[model samples]
Target: MRSAVQIADARANKPGHQIYAGRARAIIERASIALRSSTWVPIATGFIEPVLYLLAFGYGMGTLIGDISTSAGSIDYTVFIAPGLLATSAMNGAIYDSTWNVFFKLNESKLYQGMLATPLGPLDVALGEIIWALFRGLSYSIAFMLITAPLGLVPSWSALLAIPAAVLIAFGFASFGMAITSYFKTYQQMGLIQIVLLPMFLFSGSLYPISVYPDWLEFTIKLLPTWHGIELIRDIWFGVIDFSSFSHLIYFLVMIVLGLFFTTRRLRDLFMR
Candidate 1:
């Protein structure tokens, strides 16, 4: 009953559709091996930095700042900052894995070069690295949330939504980070990443509300991927669901698409050529 055009289209797409199947699995297996070799100490240690910030700023600085006002209503200063920390945790974890770990594998280790010798292609490597980064970032976000829960920072059941939101934030950052790192030929270039990331972390309404910024600056901050990420987690933590929350989701989704496009293109250029 199918038309000739439909049959032709299906036949044309078949080979391309199979490209991701076994190849992506092979790349993920490579990631699993790397994960098994990694030490738990460093992973555990990463949790400490964010917790320290939460305690120092939440409790120490909270004494002076007291409660803060948000769209969700008035909240303890510590609680107000918790979701922002979660966003930062996701960003930090993803960027570290995608940039440093990926650069090491690509350049010094020549891991991806070996990967290309197999049935896998550039897209598989790109996707596998991204998945691994998301896994690491999500782990950090979950640990931070667990630490926050006992402190009475998470008031709403909606805090559960934060897991997926954190994953999305991590995905956007990891993909974007990998795409950017593909252009770097030296370790010294990694320092430049901090120049971009630090400002986004500090000024993206993470420590304070965007309303306090100048009109132009506030508009610029809102356009940042991290700012949208922070707002998404904050809104979920406070149980504030609305159109803006969906808009934040859309922003990260766009980042993921553009990032993947660039990453796959760059990887092919680097490894396949």
Candidate 2:
């Protein structure tokens, strides 16, 4: 038999103990079931959209724009934009998975309601949904990298690091997106996501160098998560690993923590109430 002190410790730990293991597994299992019922068309479509952007801007417009200067030195317009597109794709995939899909599950299908009725709690649901978003984002990132590699866009083997970097980006955005989604009670609020994401996509140093912007605007863009992601991916693609690279990693890690904190707190309030 366990000692009284040991039993008390076990009981105390039991409240949230399963969150890191069992609850997460349950959430993932739920996602897998939903994915099995879904079609591949949407996945194929997501992969295609980024490729279209690369073709349109990287090649079609590259002819007119010529070479661009980057921290990695002057490079073809296509080469410079390619990694940024990969970052964009990862961001888009994660946002879509976490926001709209999660909204529908939270509100329409009442999915989280059902999960909360089980042994699972808000934290489990939050993590599971974010992991699923990361899964979708990673898939898109891998496909984008494969396409770019043969085209000579990924110049170094260090580009393989892009996969985990993409996951970190996705985790940050997905958690952030989920946290935002939790506060929204109506579909009309979702348009706000577009308003925010579109500008970040355009101005986050993804399509153009931040040097084109004034100092204030450039500093603001650097604060955006996607800009850090773009810079991180660009560095990995060019084989430039340094202290700044680790700083980008830290930025995303911090975002992920903040996102999870807000998401879990919001979910508990929304559901527990």
Candidate 3:
């Protein structure tokens, strides 16, 4: 009893044919509209937390510690930790949007379900949301850099690269965060994310060198995405571009690809099936 139009639509959406409809811009537009009316407190909080860390740890503790040695040579303790905090800022912003916000939309608002009911495919929704999260990350990075540069915490023009590096870091985290969030059904499960993130932020070489850890622990920290992100931003902040810099870039590129793949698949299973 199916009409021809319904039959054609089914054929178009069958299995693997229409995972993306090239309408993600619509989702981005919707996000932007929502953001315009949203409270600025959360965004301000993400920005302020890093600034406070920079003040307390970077300046206050930095005075007692003096200059620290990095791959870029001995630099002010303030300078060394600024990039790590910058990377952290980006991570916090993107993860907030992609995880908690995405969770609300997925479970509470049922936004993604409605989006998929339209012409938007799962890939479109996934990519759109990730891109919007990247915007949050980019904003945090820019605002942090603006504050740091005036304080002489930014050592070179090359440090501007950290902004883009922060975006890449955000993209990787946001992609994976959304994918992982799709699996959670309860607020208790969501608390586990904070638990993981807190430790990762502390031990990811943000405050001190991982060299202080046991060799096994050092290796484990290096395996973390945040460590790579911090290292990449730190290298740029000090203008230490090298083969290793490209390696860190490659790590995020791979993270992005795999995250997007899993997120798209999970969304398809949730709404399209």
The better candidate by TM-score, 1 or 3, is 3
Off by over 4 Å in 1: 1-22
lDDT of 1: 0.84
lDDT of 3 by residue, 149-193 (tens): 999999888789899999999999999999899889999999999
* Location of the lowest summed lDDT over 10 successive residues in candidate 2: 14-23
Query: Which number leads on TM-score?
Result: 3
Better of 1 and 2 by TM-score: 2
Candidate 2 per-residue C-alpha lDDT over 40-66 given as tens digits, one digit per residue, 9 for 90 to 100? 887787778879989999889998999
Better of 2 and 3 by lDDT: 3
lDDT, candidate 1, 1-273, per-residue tens: 987456545655456532342356667677788778888876766667778888888889888998889888888899999999998888888887899888898889888888776555577788888978888889889999998998898987779789899999999999999999988888779889978888888889888899998999999999998899999999999988899999999898888888888888887778777
In candidate 2, list every pair of residues with a backbone clash.
none
Residue 11 accuracy (lDDT) in model 1? 51
TM-score of structure candidate 1: 0.91
